[model samples]
Target chain A: MSPLLEVNELQIAFGGVKAVNGLTFSADAGEIVSVIGPNGAGKTSAFNCITGFYKPVSGSITLDGKDITGKRPAVIAATGVTRTFQNLRLFPDLTVLDNVRGGMHLYGGQNFVDALFHTPRYRKSERFYTEEAHRWLDFVGYQGGRGIPVRNLAYGQQRQVEMARAMARKAKLVLLDEPGAGLNHSEKQDLLELCRKIRDLGAAVVLIEHDMGVVMEVSERVVVMNFGKEIADGTPDAVKKNPAVIEAYLGKADEPVKADEPAKAEGPDITEGDS
Target chain B: MSDNVDTTRAPRRIGKPASRISRLFESRQLGWAAFAIAVLFPFVLASNYAMSIGTTAVIFILLASGLNIVVGYCGLLDLGYIAFMAVGAYTSGIIAKAWELPILFTIPAVVIMCILAGLIIGGPTLRLRSDYLAIVTLGFGEIIRLTANNLAITGGPSGIYGIPGVDLFGLDLSGPVPFYYFCVAVVALMVLGSARLGKSRLGRAWRFVREDEDAAEAMGIHTYKVKLAAYIFGAIWGGIGGVLFAAHLSAISPQSFVFLQSALVLMAVVLGGMGNTRGVVVGAVVISLLPEFLRDMGNLRYVIFGVVLVAVMVLRPQGFWPSRAYEPEKLDEARKGKRDGGPRPGAPVTTAKGGTP
Candidate 1:
């Protein structure tokens, strides 16, 4: 079967800087992939390009074997790709259930006339939306006031709400941007299981994470990126042993190893001269 | 960890007393009470001037509710909303006079013209955000009024007069009391329609767009289309109000569609509470009737009205009847059902190990 999402030779630039350059990756259904890198390693930039937030200078993005590159975010979302921002972007003033219902926008079972008249169709659709919103909130193990505005919830709870909102989309592919950031220990645990649950739902899951522990524990495969390019792609064990991956996270060794030298041979040429 | 969650999750209700008061106002009983008062107003005050003012206040309620759709529900600041009203009034007035037909016969023309007006004003301006949008709409309002002022068909500066009263079926709704009741019924229906629209799926999309445009877009809502829908709905409401205004006055003029008219309608929406239907109605009534009520003071009345408005703004920036921001607890109960038990008491705290599988 075709991969759920495929990004090929993607490039995005701001002025003279290439934020994401020639990045390629594919995520299949029922798999958890973690994209790990240092700060400004362009992981988020690549995610943005994939999600249609940033138009890439050049590349092709296919979801479920259909080209979706450069589509508007809403259009891309309708094609069964949903994402969460690095920063929690919950509708702060809306109720927790409303925030999750945001994901169900494409589920249009009622129109303006139905709404204005309060027809049976409108009532049925509204009831379905509310029930689905609650189910997703519970799926994420959210233990907060469902009726209150999300702004009233604690930071960790807010994160869960965002996760629930993303899951509520029922998208074929889910991209979680730093879902573990700023989360406490127990919250992160809940998030880890939530990610697994997402994968188990038969949706392809790609997450950008900084926490190596969570990344190692949850991801089936790890794709390491540095300087806007992929440096390593393998199972968690193999990627961990890849010297280029080690050098990308920690600074280079005193003597560069021959095995991983090809991956970083042009690093000096690409690195701009800055102290 | 569980203990920490419990401590932070204290059941803190928001604005308990205020919500209770709002609930009372929001009840169907309040609607019935207001309807009864409207029904009995003619009996208490039989004077022509009193009846006329009451009719105007009802029309003004329609205008404010219309503006509430654009400003409150959709969060689009439209300053030229009066243009649609002008379109409706002029279309009906000209059609009724030139064709020698009853004013009620012009309803279809009024609706079509208002829709065209909505598109003309909203198509380009809705792309602009906040202040820019407001400025453009203000300009559009002036443009429409100026065009009406200059055009001969629209009666130039002298304006259109001798416009006939509405004839519904066989009954001539021309007299002060009959017309007052007619206006009351029409305005009440319009108000109910607007309120119902606010609770629909499309309405939720509007509020979502208001809260966060990008987030709403990411959720597959086309913000532009939703905003346009709001503008069109506002135009329809205003246009219908124009029909009532023309019928009540038996005349139409460019002066009636001035920036001040738009501002007053906006003021009603803001003073009452932007998103609250009941609040908007109350605000409209107060703004429309306060000057008439203070007519005994003559010149001092204007000064007092201005002072009162300013004081209200200072005291309650959220409006006299702000919309409540809470969801019902039905979803909470649904969630609890899935959890087997709700809010575990004295549940053991569990730590998440970094390397736990």
Candidate 2:
């Protein structure tokens, strides 16, 4: 079967700058792939292009062998691609449960007429929506009050809500942008396990993360980028040892150390590159 | 690590007395109370002037509810909502006069015209956000009124007259008392429908769009289509109100559907509380009746009205009855598990803060 998502020769530019240039990647069902790179590496930009938030200058994005390039975000989302933003984008005024129900918008069994009249179908569908929202919130281990506005939750709790919202889509492919940012070590570990669980549920999971620990622990395959170009692609062990990956993470030096030696230094170096 | 987290979630609170008043207003009892008052008002007053004012207030309530769909629920700023009302009134008025039919019989045609009007105005303008949308809708409102003023079928500036009263099941509802009750029933049903729509899936989508369009789109809501749906619903409600407006007056005129009328309807939505149906109804009643009650003030009634509105805004920017945001509580075993010493079955271990396994 064709991969769940495939992008080929994707190029997008903003005025004079090429945010993503001829980047290519593919993810399959039941796989967890991480895209890790230095800041301005165009990871988020590429994710935006695939999700239809940003129109690419030239390329093809196909989902299950169907071209979906440049489609509206809602249209692309309807085809089973769901994502979380780098910043927590939970509706601040909406309750946590409502925020998650938002992901289930396309899974419709009722329309405006049913809503106006409060038909049995409307009640049934709404009940299902609420139940599923609670289920996903539970799955993500959100301990905050589901009835309160998400703005009331701590930043880390809000991140969990955003993940639950994305997962609530029940999509075939899920893209998480910096899912581990601002998370404590324990939360990051939980996120790792959640990624695996998502893959086990027969969905493709792609994440852009700065936390090397998460990228290395959770990703079955890793793709590294720098300046909008894919510089390395392999298993975590292989990518860690790639000379170019090391050079990109830690600026060029007189002597190239072994992969294990620079592992501790990689985190700070990546943080330095972010600014 | 969670000690300073402020995890003791407190129930959201407004001011003490305000919260109590809001709770009272939010209850189903308020709807019943309003309905009862509407039913009993004519009996107590009985005068033609009082009945007329009451009937007009009922129609105003319908107008406010319709505008609520677009402005309050969907967060579309409509400056020319009166245009939809005009479309409905004119379509029904012309059909009733030309066909010699009761105004009630022209409802199907009125609905179609309102939908068309909604599409015509909402299609192009829904793309523009905020202030631009306000400008375009204001233009459409004026354009609709001007077209009616110049059209012979609409009787130009004089508009259509001698429009027959609404007849239901051979019962002539032309008398003031009977018509007032009829308006009450119909307006009650329409208000109920609008409130029901506010709780539906589409309503949630509207709120989502209102809150964050980009996030709403990312969640698979077609923001444009959702917005257009709000516009159409608003148009239909306004159109139906127009049918009642025509029936109430037995005549239609361009002078009635002016920009100030639209502003008054908007003021009702804002003053009552934008998304709360009960508040909108209350706002409509207050806006429509306050002037009648202040008639002794002569021309200064409007100035007082303006001052009162400004005072209300200054005191409660959220309106009289702000829409309540709620979440349905399910069986929360996790919270239970926290209190007890045992972990809930199937509960993820990661919920324990600092327990990095």
Candidate 3:
């Protein structure tokens, strides 16, 4: 009955700089929530906190009313949470099918013993992995060679494989960090449709995206942030018209010559290479 | 997705179909043929030196296969792998002499001791990255050998002696010809087990960890535990190799488990190609027997062996038989028998280049 993922008063700081300060948000099953912010607004920092990549100094994160703050990343993911990185963080040397099978690790029916001995259960589980891999790739409309190393794929195809890998988790809550970045116009449209399809599959979808067109068209709700704090939260239409949200992205209306000069652009893009 | 976007697909070269020999290498029959040749080798060469070389080569194969699990599959650099072998040999040798039991019965205790050693070393080192792990393991390996060197329980520098030969229900397998067969059978089984593990779900998890640790963890693979598994499996294989070593020599010594020995084992893995069982096996055989074949060159045999290893590595760094493992779409559909083998309408054309396996 309650929201599936909830974050309250989450604060994380790095040395002298506070990356995310007292940020709060929540989402329920079968809903799409988008977080839009300027480059240094701590959207990714918040994501890193929730996914246990970085331990927050204060506040808590919960899934299905269970506290998950400070848990290990693997532990957090095991509780039905899956995400795609802003950059494609795929096993580049592995086949596309093997990359997707990575998500099914926790649910694999056989263990090391079965693997060593090649038991019937091992064969069945492997067949399951392959079939599920194919199914997820098809669902994402991936038409690349599933047997080749993903490094050889085009950048957009690589993103599709990353999506297929994340969706293969079948997690209850899916967080997509800039799923539309580097995508062509048509590919962006496919991603928009995929977001809705993901929501229709009874999972909560939280997206962090900079493409305003995709964000406005696909997101049911949008939360805006600037300088590590939430400035506004509402429907996409309402958030778009919010004066503060506009100021955070552009600058102050009246006298905005050089107030926030540098990061009036995109901020702290850690994934700068390996497209 | 629209098919109009050319940016979504990388143009690929469509190579000719794989050769017949390559297809043979891809099948299990090749493995069986190699095993058959090993089994029939004794018939062709019955000399004591030949049998000795044969058993030692089989043991080397076992050692290389085990190291492949850690270095090849999981990408963990282990510099002190021989320590596991030391633990196994000493555990079994000490137990056999003190308890007056057959060395065969010491298998269980040898496995347990190796596991404990694996945990001790892996617990601290698996937390670190490869460079630190390599140094730590190199240190621990020396620590293990020095401990064996000083311990009264291990007979100090003299090492344990009079290790009983493998006994099987009143049948003694300690004789040269019989023991060769024994080592061959056991090593074959172990090598097969390692290969089986390579293609399993757990095996895939290990490969994932090797390729990208962070991505693996984000996908819910406990990277630490997976790495520990690699360490433990490597230890067990090395330990079993040790037991066989003691049985072969009828004695044990710290000198047998040295850093150079570990390096040679690792070299076999690298030369054969990492993560490929067939390649490792071939590498082990070449590394172990090349010197004997070059015996006519006297001490120059060592120089020739080194040159050959360097040449092979430089020429084919990917290994003699690199892993080319993946099920093709045509093969998959043919196996399924559900769809008419025709290409579906609107399906994008995708090509598979190079080797097929």
Candidate 4:
């Protein structure tokens, strides 16, 4: 099958600094691929470009063979890519159920008239939404006060609500940015198992994660990057031993061997080995 | 981590049935009762001036509630809200006078004008967020007023005159009692619709976009669309209120739709709890009637009004009545029926690495 998403020569600049430079990658269907990089390594820049939050200076983004470069964020979202942020972005003032129901907006079971008139169709759609919200909240293992404002919940619970909201979108590809950042050990473990479960449900999962243990343990494959350039693309073990990947993470030592530079994988095949 | 210590999550047991007086005070049924009293109030009183004041108060209530949707629920500070009100009043007035149609017949035209006005103001400014958006709306309000002052179709400063009231099948709705009742019905519908919308999905989206645009968008809610919808709905509300206003006064003037009116409408939204419908109702009534109630004070009335507003704002920044604390019995019975426990214990009590399991 063709890859679910493809990015080619994606380059974005901010004045003098290049946030994402000549980056190219693709993620296949049903894969749990992790993008690993050091701080300020253009991971989020790439995510923003793909999600249409930032325009790439040079690149093409294709989803299921359709070009969707520089589209509006909502339009891009309609193409079946959804994401969560590094910082939890739950609607704090609204009830937990409302926040999750927001994910199904594009489903359009009811229009403005149905909402205002409280028609039978409206009631049916509302019931469906509440039931679906309950199911997803349950799936995420979010055991918090569902009726109250989300801001009232603890940090980890807020994170779960965000996850539930993303799941509510019913998207084909879920981009989870730093899902394990502030989560406790057990919560991180829950997240790992959840990613695998997400993959089992037939959606491609693209995650940008910093925790080595969580990334190494959960990802089907991993891509390593440094200074906006892809350094390694392989299974976890293969990437763990790749010299360039090592140099990217730990600086290269003096007197390095003048051997052949492993040719950069041509086209978007570079994303094949990354889980 | 605190699953074992579940004292906070304990459910409460009900005692005896609530008293009728207390129940009336607590439920929205009280608002309907007040509306009924306002409607029938003119029949009990013989004075035309009293009925007129009541009619004006009702119109003000509609304006306040409309404003509450944008400023209160959506967290948009619209200093130009009166412009929508102006558009509605002018559109209806010009149509009613020119075509000799009853003011009620101009409603569709009013609605269209207000929606256009909302888009014109909201489209460019909503992207600014918070204080900046407020300043832009203020400018737009002035722009509308200046445009009205310069335009001839608005009949210069005097605006349109002798605008016809509701005329239906030989019955005269022109009498003060009939007019008062009509105004009451209109205000009631506006208030009820606003309150209902607040509890619906669109209202939730407004709240979501207001609190955090990025988060709402991340949830796949188009924040811009939600904000625009809020603007349009709010405009429709203000437009309808303007229709009632022109009918009540039987004339329109550019002076009537001023910045002060916008400020006053916003004040009512704030003085009442911003997002709470009942609070807005109370706020609108008090704000409109307080000046009349203080008529005996003469010049001192303005001073007392300022002091009272300051004190209220200082004491209750969230408004006189914030949303009531969650009362399980008062909530939708379906949601209340979902449990024996108040809420489930926090997700199987994940053990912290160092803390007790």
- List DockQ, one per candidate, in order: 0.32, 0.34, 0.37, 0.18
By DockQ, who's the top model here?
A: 3
Sorted on TM-score, best first, the list reads: 3, 2, 1, 4
lDDT of each: 0.84, 0.85, 0.85, 0.78
Query: Which prediction has the highest TM-score against the true structure?
Result: 3
Residue A220 Cα positional deviation in candidate 3, in Å, after optimal superposition: 1.0
Residue lDDT tens for model 1, B1-357? 334434434376662224576667657789879888999999999689999999999999999999999999989998888888999888989999999889888988898888888888899988899999999999999999999999999998777998888788989888998999999999888898888888877888888888888788778788888999899999999999998898889888999999999999999999999988888999999999999989999999999999999999999988998877676555343333555343232233222211111
Chain A TM-scores, per candidate, are 0.92, 0.92, 0.93, 0.91
The C-alpha TM-scores of every prediction are: 0.89, 0.91, 0.92, 0.88
For candidate 2, list the clashing residue pairs, or say none: none
On lDDT, the leading prediction is: 2
lDDT of 2 by residue, B260-293 (tens): 9999999999999998899999899999999998
**Residue A6 accuracy (lDDT) in model 4:** 88
**Total clashing pairs for each candidate:** 0, 0, 1, 4
List fnat per candidate, in order.
Answer: 0.53, 0.52, 0.50, 0.24
- The model with the greater DockQ, 1 or 3, is 3
lDDT assessment of candidate 2: 0.85
Worst lDDT 10-window in candidate 3 chain B: B348-357
- Alpha-carbon shift of residue B185 in model 1 (angstroms): 1.3
Off by over 4 Å in 4: A255-275, B1-28, B43-46, B324-357
Give the Cα-based TM-score of candidate 2 against the true structure: 0.91
Q: Kindly report the docking quality category of candidate 2.
A: acceptable
Candidate 3 docks with a DockQ of 0.37
Q: Mind giving the per-residue lDDT tens digits that candidate 1 earns over A80-179? A: 8888889988888788878888888788598888877889998778877876676676667787777788877889889899888888888888999999
